[model samples]
Target: MRGVRVLFCYLILAGSVSAQNIESLLMAGDRSAYNEIMSALQRKDFIEAIIGLNSFIPGYSSYGDLYFIRGVARMQLNDVEGARKDFILAKASGYKEENINFFISKEYLVGRLLKDLKMEIKLDSLREYRPVIESRDTIQGALRPERTCFDVYFYNLTVKILPESKSIQGSNTIFFRTTADTRIIQIDLFPRYTITSLKRDGKDLIYTRNYGGIFIDFGEIIPAGKMEEITIEYSGIPIVAPKPPWNGGFVWEQEKKRYNVGVACEHLGASSWWPNKDHLSDKPDSMIINLQVPYGYQGISNGNLRSQTDVGSGYNNFEWFVSYPINNYNVTIYMGDFVNFSEEFTNNSGKYRIDYYVLPKNLKKAREYYTQTKDVIGIFEKAFGEYPFRTDGVGLVEAPFEGMEHQGAIAIGGEYGKSNNRRDYWTKDYDYLVIHELAHEWWGNAVAIGDMADAWINEGFGTYSEFLFAEEKFGYPEYIRVAASNFSSILNIWPIVGERNINSNTFLGGDIYNKGAAMLNNLRCIINNDSLFKRIIKDFYLKNIYRIVTTDDFIRHVRDYTNTDYTGFFNKFLYETDPPVLSCSYSIDRKNNLTFNYRWTRVGPDFSMPFCIAVNNKEYIRLNGTSFPQTFSYENVNSFFLPNEYRYEKELVPPNSFTYYWTTWPF
Candidate 1:
């Protein structure tokens, strides 16, 4: 019974099975049989469950749920062949393919029977559950002719946020230069908003709405290279975030009888709350944000605050100016009863200001915890060059949600780790939220991605920055521990890079953050040169600062810098769901020599990655492995005993300690 419980726990830990699903299956069948089988399972009695299942299944041969339970019981009892047969029978008896595939993909059956099943069963299950991509997705995601006809250079946005009604009234004056001679142009705003007026140079402009896209007709063809401006006046209730930073929208909440409000629209698009192009490819060169909130509440936004003025009504207008090219999503708003504090960050370049905004109650604790911001900024400057927006200065706004890299003004949440029960990853104490969102100041805000598909560039680098911070503050072992923890969360179900031009949220999964970081770490291992790796990262950031980038761009930069083509490496790691598997075997020769053979599996035919292996857990030797088997011989080693059969066929090479891959041995 203890062994059975251990096996069940192992399966849960491996992420191969869900206990809830097992419970659901147990409760689904005939009432009397369910009672018997569930009681046995509750007691961790696999033998008793198997005895009951055998009798019940024979009586109800078509019961697929019973067969699945019997398979699970057999698996726990270490009857691999019996479990395999039961699983196949269960599938043939019309059990859910997803459940069957998940069970069969476990480590126990992976090396033995997985090859016999149609691999598409798993893929088909995924396809069955994929959300239908609508026309709105295509319009928002694709670069249509209307969107490409003009290039936005600036945006002057003024909004009056009404917390009482949970609505906003605003106008965005768009300044653009024509790229092509066309009278029609497209901008995006959620259809929920009512457009009171659309004008260009004081003349009314006609527009039509479809999905979230607004197509405007200028009534005359603006010549190529012409400069133009348009102002859109609109008002509506914005979507409230179901889950912030992940699902983007306005967050309206109250703390201590005061409004604690802000907005985050990353994947959901800035258009969720305001009118804009609503695509990653377009970034305004400079902008002004004028936000009007209720009296006594401070309104904060990206970049530097230009002024705060009482508007004579019940609102105060706080205006901000962003002096550099900015992603639309990075433009945000925070309004609350806030007090301010400032610090100066001095580096090789010069002294830059760092501002903090918090509720008046949490001011003292914020000051103490936020001192680490300077250290984080300095460390990142050394790694990724001078802070990209030093001219704008740095600002941290206490937010209602976890955190977000909202350009110069980052959103930070949590109680500064004082009362929060989350564990610390580094030897020295620091806020993961602060460190992660700050890292995005360099990765996501400074060096931006042109498409959501390459969002790993933003999140992966941000996560890896935690590794860098750990290594710089503590040591390599501590960094390894952090990296291993990140690797453990990787799902590997979807590729880090998703289908392009579809507004896909595939990168929203943990893979983009965890697996993406592990991939970068693995690349460093493959390069085997810390200085060169750091140089590559710094160079990439320096070259692409304030510019949108793609995964191919970084791959090209790595190739150019390293003097080696890493296309296959990126293809395997970024484009594929699973890492390469290094299948290994060995034989003892009569001359007391051991001959080892190795090859790559579960990868492209051209996939070749270098990895290190330690013989007898001693000194490490690096070897380059490809699809074709390679051999190496070591002399004067005694013959070792071999198990009669390989139990669990594969073990994941600890990603923290080595390159990302898997290893399998047959004896």
Candidate 2:
């Protein structure tokens, strides 16, 4: 029955295999154009790559790899949205996951936007590169009893996007109950936006602004437990997302000369688009979004849409409501010419609609690619419990940027039409964007981070979810492949989990995503128990669902669940960039038996994790930092050689040849 359904969906959207063959077709449509672009890219001639790719794209726009190369070129050129768009198309086209991710990392790396992720790219020494365009001061809003005094119950936002003038006018109604007594309420909005009005209970209120904060006088010390609401009206031309998801802001793009609008305010704070208490720790229990755009375009936001109405002359209104708690940054609005397809996904959790919205021209591709949503969600639900936002269902928006784990409404820009559609290195027949963003419904969104500093708490778990997805689909070998691909992006210049009370604008390159995932993979290996690891993940989600949490909170959960002390493991990996190197040296005893000695260098004071040492491919011994003298008897083994089959992750692993093994990972 499932196969029958898949086949029917495939025919209507994906087309027959012969109809979409990727054979070498000359006459303007071929891999040579893309290869030429990649050749220039290989030589680091980003300019040449961009020019050739942009010129060649119109001819072979359906070729998936072309967009991947061009995205890399655009990142090098500092055209962030362009890079993101191309990467999305490449992902849709079925390009290799790591290939697409490698280029995406380049955008944040070269842009030098996020401080924690900046170090992954070593080319920062290059003089002619994109500088960090957006700088935010989030410490003041991060933690203060005054700002955190009230718990947000609901939010109502109405915004008018003027693309031609590049401006926005909006109002946000914040409904909250005071957790503590306070007279002044603190909310945030970028200074660029002008405050037109502030009101509570139909009475105007005075407010002062500083460092993106608006301090409003409630006029009275509202007692604790009292529920209150405030509405702020503001208008202005906001800062553009210099590089979205990193130096986030509004993204005003053009698709075939029409307006394609979206906002990625993750690092810049939601204040860039709408007024809010812009802190990760506080999330509104629910939200109502009404985005007004010029006619002929539909607006999309998180959660389900309640209405689409045309209010007289040349304008349309899209009102959406989110039924569960959401971070301010996850509150988004995308306006464009979109057509959608919907399918009901049924699993142990229940039956719900999985919708995909894309450009009218890409509807066929979206249809073909979206069928995988059911499979991906099925895997996730089995591992992480039933979908968190069943009321909201699951949605995929063809965003103008690469992608974001936007609560229930995930933005998938990889147009999959001309991309690599093969599971060549992939464990399952799934799209990386689809699987990744949905995984966030369990990790990044349902269970969120309290501070941007603890971003690894969201991203690391999200990255590991992808690893688990592969493992669930294709077993441990696939897990190794996925883990290895994730590790390739780990430059490890900074810690995965960040310090509190600071803005999350560091550029540790791919540390939070890739390195964090690697650490989790290593942790699973340390536990040497997949079932227990699975329980830890599922239980952690149930415990923190819809609540903002920290890395310490997660570490404690892991420790409590496993009944073991992993303080040093989490500390060494999450708080520091470098992993401990275990040096191996062996000696031949008088009886011709080999005695192996292992010692860790540059390790944390008490860092220890168990790893397996296989001697002569026969004796497998589990050893920690303190364990040594793992002897291999002569009768059992004459010489040593490294075992190649799946084992716990150790980045420094090498073949047992003395010179090769010793020369590989240095101290």
Candidate 3:
């Protein structure tokens, strides 16, 4: 009877592995098992999952894959020591399948778990070059009849091209979920391309090809909400040609003395060559990047550079992968003749190296200029928790424009001489642009947003961080003055509503970056508890690590942790487009009192707010009104000249046509 029981167990395990649904078995390993483990976690069956994993992991190498899985599981179980041990083992064991994501994430997650800021942990901080050929292909499985949610996965790809337009495409599968009756996959395809054809589940499917993307009608609604996998094959000129964002062939203009190039496909540029969901709300699990570039040019993408082989006919294939979940916009590529170097840094967090890939000519100047990068990195790690992506060092890609905050790699448009050219850092402090972009490794890259609406969460916070760095490295007064300057700009550009004209992308420059930063600074002042505020910021990052968040989501998080309601706070600024301007005056009275009479005219119709009024810089009182007249008095004879300072913030409910005017007793 015992032998029969053992035989039955063996059969069940075999069937599970064959079906590729060994989630139950993998669970025994740890939280790191696989995506299958995520569900078991939701149900709170952690211990059982661990047992199954321990018994089912193939070959169960205690050092590499097996140990990595164990560490992930241990983390979920709150076993920090065990998780750390497993992660270290996995890192040493060469767990490179997920772009070494397991190794890097472990370093990031453990920081919050231990709250040990002084601990020095390091990962490669490198600059990336331009992507030669990029691809993001999605496969939607046939949905089950009753399924309300369906999983969609796209392979992140980096491709290379042969001399005759022949291409080699490499991609990794990314998993996600959708609830729309039929998924509207929006791919960012800039500059346009040609679609050869497409297939669904091994069968040719009719597709509609346009500049935006090639959409295929799956024919019929989803049945049983089951799964269906769709594959597409197409090719085109590199979206970001040698000239950049829009140039077609390959020819550098000698007169320009530089390449007129840019890869500004943040958010929606991926579809310029491939098909995708195009938005931030739906992020992919893991992806593979494959590229085929002209024999002489090197192609680079999101993950660690894996292999480069000559494919003949003037074509070379390069492949990369991102093992961890990455935002759609964070996906990138770099290509050109470049020199690569790696250096090491040892600190409390661990010993890691920084890498830099720059134009060969700028080697000496690059070294001298970027020396402080390591120290600034150390400071950010202590503050923001951990670096977001894999790969070390920074990639200084040559661009025709300015710098961009690419994960792990930042593309620099200028040479080393520009470092001391008076335009280096915006405030003449430390390298503000460098520090600002690096901070995004934590805020924008690690703790991402659900949509562009919360772009302020990324840019605003990043800009604020720049100021904070200025304050710390420069001085507090500089910081205060910076904040005031931003506030003043916001006041000038006060829109009656948050509605920005898409045609005019410039609106975001002031409102999103400057105004948003000022509002955050003001909130910090009001909160007053630096210790508590700092913890809240840290907690926010830790809680949402590795996932994309939204503005409402951010507000809710502040609401939950701060034990305070920020609904009013956000409603007043972010929700309302128009800000109120105060106008009022007062007269002296015989009863040792000053009679104040004031009428307010808002910037818009729906204007309503509460503000502070100061007289002679001595007496401060609160005034309230909304597009109407109100009068109040101060009990105490004031100075011969009553200097009234009107201090107020905008409310969120104002309409597009709103404006304000103020009149007082003295007038």
Best of the candidates, lDDT: 1
Q: Of 2 and 3, which scores higher on TM-score?
A: 2
Better of 1 and 3 by TM-score: 1
Worst 10 residues of 3 by lDDT: 1-10
In order, how many clashes per candidate? 0, 28, 84
Write candidate 2's Cα lDDT for 176-208 as tens digits.
Answer: 999998998788898888899999989999788
**Can you tell me which runs of candidate 3 are displaced by over 4 Å?**
1-154, 161-191, 209-213, 220-228, 237-262, 344-348, 390-396, 416-429, 488-507, 580-667
Instruction: Please write out the lDDT profile of model 1 over residues 1-667, one tens digit for every residue.
Output: 0000011222342233233244444435566775777777664455567778777776668766667777766555434446657888888888774646644554333222222321111222344233356688887888888988899999999989999899999999999999999989999999999999899989999999999999999889998899999999999999988766666689998966789998987777899988998888889999999999999889999888899999978999999999999999899999998899999999876888999998888999898889789888888898889988888989999888768889888988766667664236664457777888889888988899877888888889998998898888776756766776675455455688977776766543357887788899988877778899999999999999999999999999999988988778888899886777677777767886878898988776777777654443333456778889999787765532111011111122322235556555441
Q: Order the candidate numbers by lDDT, best to worst.
A: 1, 2, 3
The candidate, 1 or 3, that scores higher on lDDT is 1
Q: List lDDT for all candidates, in order.
A: 0.76, 0.68, 0.49
Give model 3's TM-score versus the native structure: 0.61
* Off by more than 4 A, model 2: 1-136, 139-141, 417-428, 587-593, 604-606, 612-667
Tens digits of lDDT, candidate 3, 75-110: 434333455565677777765444233224533333
User: Regarding lDDT, does 1 or 2 come out ahead?
Assistant: 1
